[model samples]
Target: MKLWIKLAAALLSGACTVASAQNFPNRPVRIILAITPGSVADAIARFMSQDLTARLGQPVVVENRAGGGGAVAAEACKQAPADGHTLCMLHVSTFSLNPFTMQRLSYDPFKDFKPVTRMFFINEALVVSPAVAARSVEELRKLLVANSGKFSYATLQLPGADYFQAGLSEQWGAQVIAIPFKGGGEVVTALLSDQVNIGYAGAGNFAEHVKAGKIRMLAVNAGSRLKEFPNVPTFGEAGIKPFKIKAWWGMFAPAGTPEEIVNRVNTELSRSLADAKVRQYVEERFMESAVTANPAEFASFVRQDYERGGALVEEIKRAAGNK
Candidate 1:
């Protein structure tokens, strides 16, 4: 009699779990953005919303909460119910850089959230203004060494720019300045007006400008040469140490979300990217498609990136101190 009762209880538990997955996201779903509108991540989030709503049988909304280098959006995501209704868009900065760079971080990335799937990976380009005479990384280094304290670079909200600036300064024995901007558009403007000598950002930000011959891409932090810019060499080919961490965007839900719900969302998002139009949009934006086999794979990637960020922070500290 005791064995029969136990088996009945187990069957009931399994039934309830299946039911929960079927009824998930009954209301409108929200995707919190870590950056403001007009950014690459923001555009992708908004693009995915329509397809996700159809696939999930509910409305999907995107909300921008950009500030604190992704802390504001991250906090909002952490506070949301772990019911898979509220998702957040996080990049390398959120999982990798923020913990080390930002003080008094309100939420722990691994503890506070669950990885869904990586949306895309952006290859960061190190570009120089047309006004600058440098044509390659080697030339740029020579220019920096020759003109210390006279060159500056504009960066987005992430502190990785500071690391790049410091690394270059220490390596070349120059005073390279890093100016922070709120968005990529601002960074582009700074470079276009020759306000800054160089700019480090996603290749998409300067795609049109580069084609127009307004800015010159010295090097890209990609594993191989980009097809769009086959002539441009990678950092390794340019004789510079490639950045250890990659800049990628992924989806996340508040921790404690049911595994079934998380998997369901991941499946839908993957299907959405499979659409030809979506794939084209991503490519035109200069983003590499970075879909993972499963959420566990993404989680593993994040853990590795987190360790790399720690190493980078130490390197930045040493470089800054030496300078």
Candidate 2:
């Protein structure tokens, strides 16, 4: 009699789970970020929130849980119900950089969050302030070798900028310190003021400044020359190799979120990216909108992102001799 009762209860529980998923997102949805409120992360999150609320017919909100290289927001998402209402919108760094850079991460990015969709990829660029005489990367490297302790590398929210800077410094056998700022805006400010000699930052961060003649881009990490700068060379053309540190953004929900909700969220993202206004906004920021596949494909890519991130971090640590 007890065995029969337990079996009935299990079946009932399974039914309830399916029923809840069908009524998914019955409440307000919230997206959390680990960046400052006015940052690119916040802007994208708010934009997505507005679009999702309109389409999903729920009051979607943006929550800023900044700090600890995105651990703060990620952990908050971890503890939330896996109902798909609560989500995290984060940079590629949270998965690609934090694991190796941060000494202790509170949650496993892979296990705590389920991949929903890839939002966009920001083209990264290497640039120098007008105070620096170097016009190209080769020239810049030579200048650094000559004036070893005089210049520095500016890093913003992208912490791995330091790792790449360090790698460059090691390769060139020069001393270009990695100076970190809170956001891209600040890095732009410092670069403009000649407080930092050079920086590897999102192309969006330097676009206006580059146009105003405040700084010069040494090389850009893109497939080919951008229409805006038809004359500039790509990293490969500049003889800079394997420096493909990606600047991408993705959306995710709590680990236990139902697969149905995950697929729904991904669909919503695809729709938003296809929106003409949203695409224009992304382009204005010097970012390219993504063409993401379905949930399972994105999840597989997320797993690969972590694996590649781990290997890159390990390589950096070994090169720096971090025991």
Candidate 3:
């Protein structure tokens, strides 16, 4: 009788676990945003959260825990229980570039998080202040070469955006100085204030500035011209061949979250991405929906991005010869 009772207890425990996993997210779900309120990241999170709330039958809330180049929010998500209730919207720079930029990182981009789905891709645009003489990408390259080291550009981050600018300078044989700012908003402010001759930032961040004639988008770092800015030539079209780098956003959960839960989230996110409202929201915001990928595919994409970013960092380190 003792043995039978033990067996029954074990089965009951297993059944309860299964039931809990199945019911998953029985309460409200929280999404941690690594950026401050009113930021582009926050805006995207809000849009997605609203859609998810309707689809999941649970309130989806976005909580901003901004700091440390997104490490703060990421760490918070990492420390959260490995339940589907707590998740984060991981940016490309945080997951892929931070590892290469920061000397010491707290969490493993891969091992510490389970990727759910890629939300959207925001391509960066290379824009010059109207005060600059250059109008097109080639013209800008020539102007930079002629002025060599006289031209300065601003980027949001040190090793991510600035590193890409460094690579562009090397590839184009231009002596451009890269100035770092706290965020994209500051970068735009500096460009508008004529504090910097050139700046690199997401199209969404500079859409109004570009429209206002405060900045001229010379070339876009995308395979082709974006739908919103079709008139603006791509880097390739402007003779700056092989210049494509897209900043992506994706959903992630704490590592060790149940596979079933992760799959459920991924499925819902995938559906959300496909919804006309979501697509329209992204389009209006100058973002493009990335092709939907499952957990394995998202993991592979993150790994590839990490490797690519690492290589870029190595090249920058070699060029600068700094520790």
Better-scoring candidate (lDDT), 1 or 2 = 1
lDDT of 1 by residue, 32-124 (tens): 888877766677778879878888999999999887777889999999988888999887778888898887899998999999998889878
| Candidate closer to the true structure by TM-score (higher is better), 2 or 3 | 2
TM-score of 1: 0.88
Candidate 2 lDDT (Cα, whole model)? 0.78
**Model 2, residue 69: C-alpha shift (Å):** 2.7
Ranked by lDDT, the better of candidates 1 and 3 is: 1
State TM-scores per candidate.
Answer: 0.88, 0.88, 0.87
In candidate 1, which residue ranges exceed 4 Å CA deviation? 1-20, 157-161
Candidate 1's displacement at residue 115, Å, is 1.1
Instruction: Give the C-alpha miss distance for residue 296 in model 1, angstroms.
Output: 2.1
Q: What does each candidate score in C-alpha RMSD?
A: 3.6, 2.7, 3.2
- Local error of candidate 2 at 22, Å? 2.8
Clashing pairs in 3: none
